[model samples]
Target: MVNTISHIHCQNCSMAPLCLPKNLSEGDMARLDTIIQRHKPLHKKDLLVTADAPLRYLYAVRSGSLKSYTLDDHGVEQIIDFHLPGDLVGFDALATGRHRSFTQALETTMLCEIPLNSLDDLSAEMPVLRRELMSMMSSELYTSKQLLGSLNNRAADARLAHFLLGLSQRFADRGLSGKSFRLSMTRADIGNYIGLSVETISRILSRLQHENVLLVENKLVEILAMDRLERLAG
Candidate 1:
């Protein structure tokens, strides 16, 4: 954990609507800045919140990404959710003091910590805050439902296709790209979530690359033949 967060990167990301930096604009966003606190920058594989850890603040992703997952009895990691820039990560701890899943940074990550009690007070004072909170919750529910639908109805290829598409959408939402993006999650993590093996993931990726559908280099995925990739995903 590096103390003194990188503020310049914060400026670059804040201007984009994807991250919660937009929370600074007007209404409650203004009030939010008053109580919000930035934590130490986390490098790859750093744990933000551990399962069963005490919940103190509402977390917002300033930059980078986070993945939350839990271990089964056999010690296999089951990914719960992946949080992108401007996304909230620790909502499940709102009512409970203990976290149900552990959240870890996927890259060099920055975070905004809002004391839950302070947010509660602000929500009481600002109707905009309350409404926005409700909307965020609703949106998350819809996303979960959609992911569940994919898991139930889509095949392995389609599921992976949809997963990549979903990532593109989230990236685009945060002012990133549908055609190019960085992959911080490992093939094993992706395989576990999509019910595939790591070797299978590698094979599929290579197959796609060989077909000129995309290019994968050092965790960067470039959509060379974007439509072709989408077709395979179908």
Candidate 2:
């Protein structure tokens, strides 16, 4: 049987609007609840969906973060995207009924797993839910397109600068220290996502630190000059 929850209030619940179908009424939410499954708590670095695993559930983060990646023909891991609290892990996988990439938790996480087969039924029955689902899919595509543009047109420094700001905004959404947050993604992951080498990523970060754009303390980044960081991002 699928696990179900009642309501989602961003201020109270761990998951926010990212996972929840926005503007869903009590009746709509109740219908979705019937097919929702609550997954087990995951620890940091715990693998959720490995490449080629049976794609069964579309997971929404109830708490914490997840990172999805895939290995190329050369066995080089390319970090695809980062999914923090309220982010959805896989929905496209349902099309093929197979996972094409790996998804692992960056921090201890709890997820709400919705059986893929049931999603269509819910969407068809609820107009608001259907629109919200389409919105999420559009947002994901937009993020991917943005990433491609950044890789093609932006310099490595600008890429890293923009990436940091994006992360800051994500952190702020979860009530975390947005500007002075710790990096959960590794340098290698960062390099892969930004289309740069680990050395290059390090160099750019070091340059930013020296430029007084931020104060670095291990994995933590404290922004010292917001305007300077914005200038670098551009």
Candidate 3:
């Protein structure tokens, strides 16, 4: 059965600092809470939104991770981005009112959905939320640029190192351990995101492990030498 959660007050939400309600007044927090719809855990691989679907709400990852990807003309899946807890999804729909990619849970995930219309209406009364949304969108754009830069004329090892380092920093931002973490996405998904074949990704991981730079067993990654990884990323 699909699980659903009852709405909760924004002031009590752990994700408020990382979400649109960051720095909001108590009055604004209460107003923001009214528009949020909470969901129970979504099993891994369950789609939260699909490409071309009508856009109604923006989803915030309250827990776990998700991936956003799209299929090309030849039907090959191209991963666009991975969303961690506290990251916002569905902003790509803002321009066209339809999703441009599919967002799927990478693990059992919980989300808080913010109705777009209600958010806009509430934003007028709570300007801080509006500014927060803009800031979040800008941050997404910057991340996209970084992705593009990473994909351009870079070695496979460098790309992988960069990706790992990036993930580490993102986790640290969420108050999670940066040195040790599990990868929610598989090797193939990582390969797709980094523009490499699965075999190549495996080889790179093996090399890193041999060099004592990382400890990778299945999806779990322990960064044994972050300084070395950063230098390799450079």
Winner by lDDT: 3
What TM-score fits each model?
A: 0.88, 0.89, 0.96
lDDT of 1 at 168: 84
- The alpha-carbon lDDT assigned to residue 129 of candidate 1 equals 71
* Model 3: worst 10 consecutive residues (lDDT sum): 1-10
Task: Give model 1's TM-score versus the native structure.
Answer: 0.88
Order of candidates by lDDT, top first? 3, 2, 1
- Which segments of candidate 2 are over 4 A away from where they belong? 1-12
lDDT of 3 by residue, 9-114 (tens): 5687777788888888888888888889887678999999999999999999888999999999998899999999889999999999999999999999988888
Query: How high is the lDDT of residue 127 in model 1?
Result: 70
List the candidates ranked by TM-score, beginning with the highest: 3, 2, 1
- Report the error of model 3 at residue 81, Å: 0.8
Per-residue lDDT over 108-221 for candidate 2, one digit per residue giving the tens place of the 0 to 100 score: 877878787788787887888878877888888898888888778788888998899888888887777877988877888888888889999888888888988888877889
Off by over 4 Å in 1: 1-16, 19-27
Query: lDDT of each structure?
Result: 0.77, 0.80, 0.91
* Candidate 1, poorest ten consecutive residues by summed lDDT: 1-10
